[model samples]
Target: MNAITHNTVPTYQRISVKPLAVHIGAEISGVDLSRPLASEEIAEIRAALLQWKVIFFRDQHLSHAQHVAFGKQFGDLTLGHPVFGYEPGHPEVYSVGRDRFKSRFDGARLVRPWTGWHTDVTAAINPPAASILRGVVIPPYGGDTQWTNLVAAYHGLSPALRAFVDTLQGEHKFTPPEGNKARQEFVSKVAATPLISHHPLVRVHPETGEKALYVSPSFLKNIVGLHPRESEQLLALLFEHVVRPEYTVRFKWEEGSLAFWDNRSTAHLAPVDIYDTEFERQLYRITLVGDVPVGPDGKPSVSIEGEPVAAHSVE
Candidate 1:
């Protein structure tokens, strides 16, 4: 496929949310998230998501059913929290709740402390393609989700670094980094599922055919054939590169707002600043199915682009 020369402008209708970008994301208005969407409208929404990596719908009054139905337009749904139970009659919906409250049943924490940059289910052999998250109760301040454009990050790499990373394989597992006793305990109590898988460092977008950096600091354990210290340093550098502010966008959440993001080409972090407070933040999330990852070189491996090149190298 030919490279996309200019970004595609989104065609909008009836909605109030303004378009945040031309190529990848939009904000829709004048619609209630609680209500059902028409077939044609759903099609338009899907198209927007495909071109833009994210789409935001604001001021929605979504019921569990409404949220699930909206997500179904994109693809098959996956169950949230392999261990924690779901809301009644809505098996696909995962409820995120605050940690301060004691519940009769098990529920995942929705507090700010849990916010970290990650893609949904990178540990899975086949991770989700997209995710739809609806804010239920939001904090007064200090909880926002930030997303990075991996495609742009990858394109900025030098050809030699790109080629080197294209051939390397990295391991992704559920183990929390050594140290941090509190987090380790939390992981054990959650009975968090551990997954081991391999993915290419550089991945080709199935639809757009653009290459993206696929590494995440949270899930990736090490690159194959590297020493522990070396792996840690290398992965840390790559993570910093992918998360540079210029390639990222931050979205502040509002009660009744919904954000849909493509897990394939983006990595996100939820900021956790509101700690030890009465304020509670909750969100409902749904993950969609994805295929096994493949690299730009047509290999079943991952790659990382190193430091920027000298100015002379460009000309």
Candidate 2:
């Protein structure tokens, strides 16, 4: 992997980037996120995000406002969630895992294999282009999050399959599981504010112009205009290919660790290992507003149910 040289970003002279995997993740050092960033520093960090898909930082414990401020450096921040709403005072901060007031039954309580994998809020017409997550409380031995590089996964497909998927579109919706005893409130909220989006199976990156497989099993319902059986078979095949070990990176979180990822070109899986155990995990996340996905054919995604997620207001 080519290092971000002084020529690339002048401020990167002090910043060091180390790749954690060949395709996806990198750890960045020599920059403190707790404070404000200069224009050149922001540019360097953005460049690293475009190249690595996901960048990690260790030992920078940020406050809720600090995290939101950091995310606003790149672009306008989206509300914590389209359906679930935001943390009390911080409209841009989304609290994950178990916390003092809320238990596991409140958020992402279900633990099925398919339910763990998703791109953040893809059910919206315009999904977030990027997401920043900071680790607050972490468990000891379990709870590792994994991210897969969709650009690499798309290229890994056979040429014929790539051509085929380039012409297809899929429907995504946040539907609650049937007969699940755990999250009844989650089900009620989803039913009240239904969201569904129709997006291309392959989306072209707005900034880099690269094509990525836009498959999020958790939200993607089916391919548009195809027979149910055919759609199911094809989606299952793509899902299996996207998470191959070679194109993915697993991250272990600590108290002050943070992960900033390009949501347009990746899918991530949250761990289920800490669910029933005695351990507790908590993380805070903020996302940047993204445009509607455009396919290689230059068609933009359409909203089927619900309004587009609005930008977060500090007021």
Best by TM-score: 2
Error at 185, model 1, angstroms: 7.9
TM-score for all models, in order of appearance: 0.79, 0.91
Per-candidate local distance difference test: 0.68, 0.85
Over 10-76, each residue of candidate 2 has an lDDT whose tens digit, in order, gives: 4356578899999999999989998988877777888888889999999989999899888887888
Candidate 2 residue 205 Cα shift, in angstroms, is 0.2
TM-score of model 2 vs. true structure: 0.91
lDDT of 1 by residue, 178-287 (tens): 33233434465345444567787777877678788888767777888889998877777778888777777778889988998888888888655655677888999877
The most accurate candidate by lDDT is 2
Candidate 1, residue 125: the lDDT equals 67
